[model samples]
Target: MSWEQIIFYLFAALAVIFAFLTVTRRNAVHAALCLIFCFFFIAGTFVVLNAELLAAVQVLVYAGGVVGLMLYVIMLVRGEDASQVKQALGQKIIAAFISVLLVIQIGSIVYLSFAGKATGRLAQEMARYGNTESIGTLLYTKYIFPFEVASVLLLAAMVGAIVLAKNKLER
Candidate 1:
């Protein structure tokens, strides 16, 4: 196999393993760390797919900013004991079933979408304009309003989080 294929497989394996750990880990801090690794591996996959802008943004925005914020929150909310939390058998079974179904649905959709013609078209488009410049131009020109809206949403979320974390009673 080619180096690209090998790298892709490696990143995909790491991403899947870390994502599973993120969901299943008992400790909240450990889960957050696992999620960071998952994000890193996903960034690697984006790099392998020649999406340098996306890879950089993934690492900067998700791995660095978001994870740092999450770690800070986790530290602030540290509990004396986390092991005492218990999950019911029925809840576990239901969660597992939902996870399995969601995975199967996603796999089916991906498989069907990229089975033949769609893959060729995607490749063609990527080859034509899969660079930072094209993405920036599109974002600023065509999708400017949506981009601004997303920034507003993020700002609102941050404000809400800070409000929720404050100890003072609101009058």
Candidate 2:
């Protein structure tokens, strides 16, 4: 196999391992750090795919910005609030069912998208202006609204975290 394929497989495996650690860790800070590494692996995949802009954004936005925000929120959480909350058996069963459904849904969607894809204009565009420039143009023009909305949503989450921290402190 090629070196690129080997690197891709390595990155994918590390990403999954990090993601599992992120979700399963008891400490919020540790989990957040694991998640940051997971994001780094995803960024590495973007680089392997020749989408340099996406890789940079993955590092900057997800690894740097979002993870920084998560660390800040985790720091704000009080010790008592950090205690593990035990889930009931029913809740665990429901969560497992939902997860299975989500996996099935995502698998079908991916299969359908691959099976139905016909056009290949993307290669032509990439040949002309390159991936980064094309992404920047499209993101600025067509996806501007969603970009703004995402920023607003993040702002709301930050505010909510602060509010929760404040409430915990007041009690």
Candidate 3:
């Protein structure tokens, strides 16, 4: 295979490995760290796919913002409380079954795309204006309302969280 393909496979494998580790780790901090590594590798895969904007967002929004927030929350929890949170055997079995199905679905999608079945309006737009431009055009034109609604919802949630936390602090 070519260098780009090799690098893409490397990143993909590492991303999968770290993602699995993230779920399987007993320690919360280690799981968070594994999740960050998985995000970084996913970003690398995006870079390899020539989606630089997506790569940057993956690193900044997920690896930097979300994982950092998760780490801080993990630290705030007492060790015993965190350790006591456990899944029953039946839950673990169901989760593993669901995970296997999800993996199979993803693998099929990747196979089909690589086998050249991926084509449509989005592909045309991507080829025309490129990744970032096409994404921006679609986001602003087609999905503007939903985008704005999500932003407003997020803002409301943040305000609610702050109010609740402040009330708890006052007690």
Candidate 4:
């Protein structure tokens, strides 16, 4: 394989490993640290894919902003409250099923792309308008609603995290 492909695979593997570690860790701080590493690896993959803007955003937004905020929330949580929660058996089974489905979906997507079933339309657009411009155009035009919704959802999540932390502090 080419150097780029090798680097991409390496980044992808590390990202997956860190993500799995993030989910499986019992300690919230350790999980958050794993998540940060996962985000960094994902950013590396984006860089290998020639999407530098996405790589930067992944680092800045996820690794820097979101995970930092998560760490604060985790710290604000009382040790007893955090330690008392445990994953149910049903939750584990459901998570495993979802993981299997995601693996199958990803495998199918990779197969289709390798088989040349994936459309070249996106590549054509990227070539013509350039990566950042095309992404901006699509995000502001076609996918504006979803983009706005996502922002609002993120805001809600931040608010919820703060509220939960405050509640824990009060107790």
- Tens-place lDDT per residue, model 1, 1-171, is 778778989999999999999888888888989999999999998877778899999999999999888888778778314657677889889989998999999999988887754212345567776678789999999999999999999999999988987899689
Error of 4 at 9 (Å): 0.4
After aligning candidate 2 to the native by TM-score, how far in Å is the CA of 74 from where it should be?
1.5
Candidate 1 lDDT: 0.86
- Model 3 C-alpha RMSD vs. true structure (Å) is 3.8
- Model 2, residue 88: C-alpha shift (Å): 2.4
Model 3 pairs whose backbones collide:
none
Q: What is candidate 4's lDDT per residue for 11-80, written digit by digit as tens?
A: 9999999999988887889899999999999999887776877998889999999899888867876432
Give candidate 4's whole-model lDDT: 0.84
Give, for candidate 1, the lowest lDDT window spanning 10 residues: 116-125
Query: Order of candidates by TM-score, top first?
Result: 1, 3, 2, 4
Stretches of candidate 2 above 4 Å error? 79-81, 112-127, 140-171
1-171: candidate 2 lDDT, tens digit per residue? 778778888999999999989877878788889999999998897767777788898899998998898888678665325747775679768987999999999999989878866433456658879888888888899999999999999899889978976745654
C-alpha TM-score for every candidate: 0.83, 0.70, 0.76, 0.68
Clashes of each: 0, 0, 0, 0
> Would you list the clashing residue pairs of candidate 1?
none
Each prediction's Cα lDDT score? 0.86, 0.83, 0.84, 0.84
Model 3 agreement with the true structure over 1-171: per-residue lDDT tens digits = 688778989999999999999888888899989999999999998877768789999999999999898888778764324655656889889988998999999999989778865223354546767888878988999999999999999999999978976735654
